[model samples]
Target: MTTRTPQELAVPVRGGDLAVTRWPGEGPAVIALHGITGNSLSFGAVAEQLGDIDLYAPDLRGRAHSAGLPAPYGIPAHVEDVLTVLDHLGLRQALLLGHSLGAFTTAVAAARHPDRFPRVVLVDGGLGFPIPGGADIDEVIESVIGPAMRRLRTTFPDADAYRALFREHPAFTAHWGPHIQAYVDRDLTGEPPEIRSSCVLDAIRADGAGPIGDPETLAAIHRPEVRGTMLWAERGVMNEPQGLYDEGRLAAGDLSPDRITTRRVDDTNHYTILFAKDATAAIAEAVRTELKEM
Candidate 1:
């Protein structure tokens, strides 16, 4: 399969607009969704690893290119935005792949619009994280990754700097390659100065950390028509033992196997799972195998 460069797009959604990127090809369409703060570029490696098809990756309303989305960015709203993109593409059904925050949206979309997609892949997200009886989700996310989240405010002087920074991140070091470089290329814009990145901090937090998660939301995800599979990083911030320093992710709670067939990929962390060669191969093979069954 040949990998193509990403093209910019703007699609209308309920709250405002969705910033989208497409890699055109001939075959069944596949909609790839990014996590919090991530844009269409997030799916670069997965798209390359998968079949030759029309790929659609959208930056949800509140993040990346579509940073002006209104408040209260919840699951329902995210599902609606996905629907809007499908409608805009004139596709009644397609494969759905979502990561982190995107996974939550994917589950909600498949649940709400059972006929809209035939297969949905959850990339280590959307599970109901353990929450105290009355604790605040936003506060929790902020406290856990405060420094990293705050760094979102600092824009890179150039793509090289951004790439170098990402390379240094424990998540991207081993995974940085052509696909990642291509993905980061889309975020560059400027005159001769060449400013880097299009992500917005407030928008990401508003959308990802806002709605949080509850049993009701998790239970609400039940899409029989949409074949479901979840891919998780074996060793990462999201799947570690609970403790004072731990992020309190995997330790939160276990998921019902009946809903999603989960798989653990070795030698990958949350961020690298979508890009690393071995990790991408695992995800692609799983998706292909599931689609064939469907």
Candidate 2:
């Protein structure tokens, strides 16, 4: 359909390349990191909401056209990759906006190198999840995000399927109908059937559980300069409200609120919050507020 991020730059990192799209505007640069199984388009709606601001959204390694990134997906590696891109671009500081798994990655980066990013926003994730014992990463995925992933796979045999699928989601039903539709439209290809989706199934699987890395490692990181904020879907299946309530209290004992903030997006769920109009507006406001404050 329409390409909002046209200035695409391929930056090589560790094991693969990141397909980064830069949109120039006044103000400090903003880096948008998509969730697992997602690409730069994940921030499409939110980007528009931010208006005239320098934006950089990257297709993380191994996802979509950014294939062949290093395996064993972990936060440290992903953060380093982003650093390489920043250095290559000569950006001294940036505002990081990450969703789902990408949120966790941004947390690691901000915590590890606070100087790299002065402001950060996590859109539904970073607090981590609670799974059953003896559960492998695959099992966790199947139990949590698999339904949406599979639904996307089956619904998008064509362009209409993507729109139809988003329409069906309880979270995005009343959101940016056109923008979400456009983001999904970008994946369209082939004739006869015209299927779409740039997501790499294997990459989704590999990058699954590694973002959690080690709690001890996360605790040890202290980035005083980084001011962080989180936007969580109230009805998220993964980091359910009750769970985050508990995790937040615990994280507070270790992490400072001045450094991190978490706000719940009401009437939204994990799958739909990013596209939901009101939710996206809230997300944009949160990011803008954080950046302005910083």
lDDT of every model, 2 decimals: 0.68, 0.67
Ten-residue segment with the worst summed lDDT in candidate 2? Answer: 237-246
Please provide, for model 1 over 208-280, each residue's C-alpha lDDT reduced to its tens digit, 9 standing for 90 to 100: 5433545445654444544578787765543233221122444444445565677777777777778878888
In lDDT terms, how accurate is model 1? 0.68
TM-score for candidate 2, residues paired by index: 0.80
Q: Pick the candidate with the highest lDDT.
A: 1
Task: Report clashes for each candidate as comma-separated counts.
Answer: 0, 3
Best by TM-score: 1
**Clashing residue pairs for model 1:** none
Q: What is the total number of backbone clashes in candidate 1?
A: 0
What C-alpha lDDT does candidate 2 achieve relative to the native structure?
0.67
